[model samples]
Target: MDTVETLGKYEIKRTLGRGAMGVVYEGWDPSIQRHVAIKTVPLTDVDDPETQEQIARFRREAQAAGRLTHENIVPVYDYGETANVAYIVMEYVEGPTLDSLMKNQERFGLPEILRIMKDLLAGLEFSHERGVVHRDIKPANLMLTSNDRAKSRVKIADFGIARIESSSMTQAGTMIGTPTYMSPEQFMAETVDSRTDIYSSGVLLYQLLTGERPYEGGLSAIMHKVLHTEPLWPSQLSVTSPPALDAVVKKAMAKRPNERFATAAAFSEALIAAASASAAVVSPPPEDATIIESRRPVAGPVAQPVSVPVATPPKRSMTPILAGVVVVLLAGAGGAFFLLRPSADVPRPTPSPTVTTPAPIPAPAPAPVAKPEPVPPATVAPVPVVPRNEAVAPAAKPAVSPAMISDMFAQITATQRCAFIGGSVGNNSEAVLTGIAGPGARDDIRQTIASHAVPGTMQWNVANADTVFCPALTLLQSIAPPFGSADPVLALTLADNRTTLHDGDHIRPRLTMPNFVGYLRVDYIAHDGTVQHLYPQVADSSGAVADKVHEFVPGQKVSLGDPSAGQPGWEVAPPFGTDMIIAVASSRPLFTRPRSTNVETAATYLRDLDAAVHAVRDGGGTLVGNALLVDALAK
Candidate 1:
């Protein structure tokens, strides 16, 4: 086996990265007097014929990547097998791994991501020509080094799982790559070619643009989604994603492998085009007026006319002037007859038979010279309603002060974690039950919105940024009676209670509570499909109870108040406790077929939960309480 400390003459300095195949180590090579990346695979990895075959496959990948000596491709220097280990030596580059970059930095602008995308494409093209496919392309396997953060050069790394056309390694039906970024074909164990890598790069690119991963759920859940579900478009995350980028991303991640880019080079080219198209959408840079002025010849300013010579006033002939006035008066009267009269020019008056004028034997009027004719007046159009995200009519007044803006954001974020998780999945307006917007997430989303908005108000551009800020500022503006800015907390509390819920409200995704003590499920009546999931709930859980649903299953923790089959934590908790109560009209959904495995049922159950939510929102009056109170009154 190739030892770690010194691989032949190279002294291993430290571990660079580790994987199932081998460990990458930073090593000192005396011959080159420079640091080099050395990978050592111990014989234990391929102790038998099976591993040995895989190692042979590794050699083919190394060769394919080795031939790709581009700046973005990790260049290989040597490859060999010792005992049960196979080792690869390559040039050492000083930069953070793409994985690290992503982990540290949540997102990058389109321009920055495109630069990395292009570099990756060129390297991929170099490998694909030799019929090599880097099936496991993820952020961790990429490296970046640069002076400018936006223009950092990216290098593709870890081609250990590279698939070559002739290689007889990596058997079918065996899941190998990261499921989050894996393409459907890889999940199916189908023959993966270059297109598979393209799909993965698309996923990677999406992640870089949106700090969140494209798919959600556990490993198995992700695999199922990758194999069956379609990802939401990047534009959904934020409107900032250019339409062109969205198209390219969609094409690259198309469910049908054939629909994806044919090659990495093709993907890169498409990316380039998308970026160019996005740039074209922006206005051209302003031209310098100085240049325009220089081009124009200014003849020295015209001299002002001094009273050089005033012409003598001309005298008019009295008889002709008087006759001319009479002629003008007659012409004006004659013109008014046709101009204001409702003859042919205007519609006839409704009242008829009042009087009829005799037709005059008039001159032909030069036979009425025919002209092209005038166009009809255009009808007035109603103005369109401005979208909530778009700027409304210009602000009546300047924005609130920065201090007020900060206070508003802090107010909402302060109580971010102050959310409820009393119901099961589909609770809290039918969102995923058990979502823990825990204080952390609540604080994060609130702060994120404020961070974008406060500074956003400083500019007139930025879509929806000002809108979001306006409403939030308005909420803050109404916090207290006129002069309550001095005490921001009371104002915020007042605003929180009075303001209608907007999308930005700190309505955290409810996480399942640890203790749902003393809750008893009174009953549930659910159909095959309905948004109203749980209703008329009661629980024994004793504490500062939010609603009756919490009292139903005191020990059973629920994420949201809503409950359904696909609900994560709502399943029959393995062995149902005799003491625990989960009352339901029908446990199984009425319909056998669902929209998407369980979406119909999820929506159905969310509806059932409306009663509990209403009770909480309006007043803590259970359906049972109303019936009992009414019965007492009747008696």
Candidate 2:
């Protein structure tokens, strides 16, 4: 098949990608001075009004996804239809889908997956909030844009199968979703909600946490397990996998929507907690802990998105052949008619690790492992510290600031795509370090939280989520509305979601891997054997640092890293004081009126994440929208 010469003004560059819905193209927008992605759906093997309607749904998908504009959510630039083809114009993101990551790595480490989950959650939250349900939240739909890109670009893609959960899903009756990742209710073709997406997300995460699917079998067998069987706990899949992750997978794959998280943000928060716990134990590794996480920095060529034209999508084909409809879920029912079978024919679960592994295995959390041992390796550089005048030490800054906490909340909510705020709660096991813990240990918890915050990173580590109940209560009384409304998505109460481990059970959630020697710009330690530090050439991409600002005035012209004002050693005092980290918002809605691919489609949405950041900073602890809305995108 030869490539098409053109689509409208876009000169077809090449076929960038393809999916079940349509083909994507890399095209040149000669007049626009930039590259654009064109998605077009062509009429394929079909006949009759029924088939036409199915194609119509594809066109409608273009209409739906084109309206959204969040960073994590793909952006639709334009839409139109030819007599035989329909197309859409969009921003080409740069990276492979989370599916590629999982495929490449078998299972992603907890930290990387957590980061990916946050991005996906933010995009989903935005869509869900805007009356859309992705309907298919599999890894294939979630793209991983480089955080290092000039645009800090990250996005979720492929919303062709989305349906308006509030109404459309019922009539659509579309049998959508990958079997291994499909929520239990999806197989039944039952009424679904945001919870359905949650279930799928859990399944995908389970696969990411463990190299294997929770219940692996052929298509027919997997469907049977999805419909009527439970899954093995994540810990059971890999002894190195934290048991804490088990709850997350279970919650995400819960049979009932009510049993799952109410929003993508909630699930993300749970994931963050798991990561934090894992990090804590890894930092100062527990004795005899098995190696977990990677020691080397991540490496891969960033996948750049090529824009394609929007085309009329095929109508929703509500009926698809489900080959395994009655293989397992109804197996026992069939046996009732032949009740003469002996009791010995039935299978009884025995209590061996192998036997237990086949079912809902109770994977006990490992002794805190997966964290790298503290090393004098040149890759993990020492953190910089700021010296302060003892006279002003008490006034230097508060251990925790309301604004700092608020900023963290905003950034995490945006980036992690959770409506929840993450900080350490003041709680710890006073048992004086019984055995070991994972990355989620209190110490590693402090370090990871420390990674993002400077002076006042609030923490809920070494403590239950209730430890931060004071702030939770404050947020309830002062923040926004609908905290306890019918949606209940933003209920003020924070869910601990941590594994309820017995004493002596080494538990943590930090992901420690070796660094990459490729580039040494930044460093973090890991526990994985033979892990190395990885860094890219930042010297060329970034400008040389300017002189540090001596004053704290807003928009001051001073550059970062001022000469250690009075003393040269001041910068190395300690990592805790005067360190600054950038925070970007990452949260999005979990529900939407119509499912879509555009990142901006959520009920409460941000068309531009970069813009949202400045608005948030300017608002100074106030809502970033309203009068703050500018005329940039409107033009």
> Backbone clashes in each candidate structure, one number apiece?
57, 123
- In the range 409-435, model 2's lDDT, one tens digit per residue, is 322221211111222212221111111
> Runs in model 1 with CA error above 4 Å?
1-4, 20-22, 45-60, 83-85, 146-151, 279-635
Q: All models: lDDT?
A: 0.41, 0.39
For residue 221, what is the lDDT in candidate 2? Answer: 33
List ranges where model 2 is wrong by over 4 Å.
44-50, 147-154, 165-173, 279-635
Q: lDDT tens digits, residues 1-635, model 1?
A: 23447777778888877777667799887987988888776667445986785677577667877877788888888787665457788878787777876777544555567778888888788878877888888888888765456656888887877887777676576656788788887876777888888998999877765555666434433554465445556544433454567888888899788899888888988888777766323221122100000000000000010111111111111111100000000000000000001122222212212111112222111210011113232222212221212222221222334333333333322222211111111111111111111223333533444433322221101011111112111211111111111111100000111111221112101111112112222211111111111222112133111222222221121112211121111221111111101121111122222222122242344343333323232231211100000000000
Instruction: Return the lDDT, model 2, position 220.
Output: 35
Q: What TM-score, to 2 decimals, does candidate 1 have?
A: 0.47
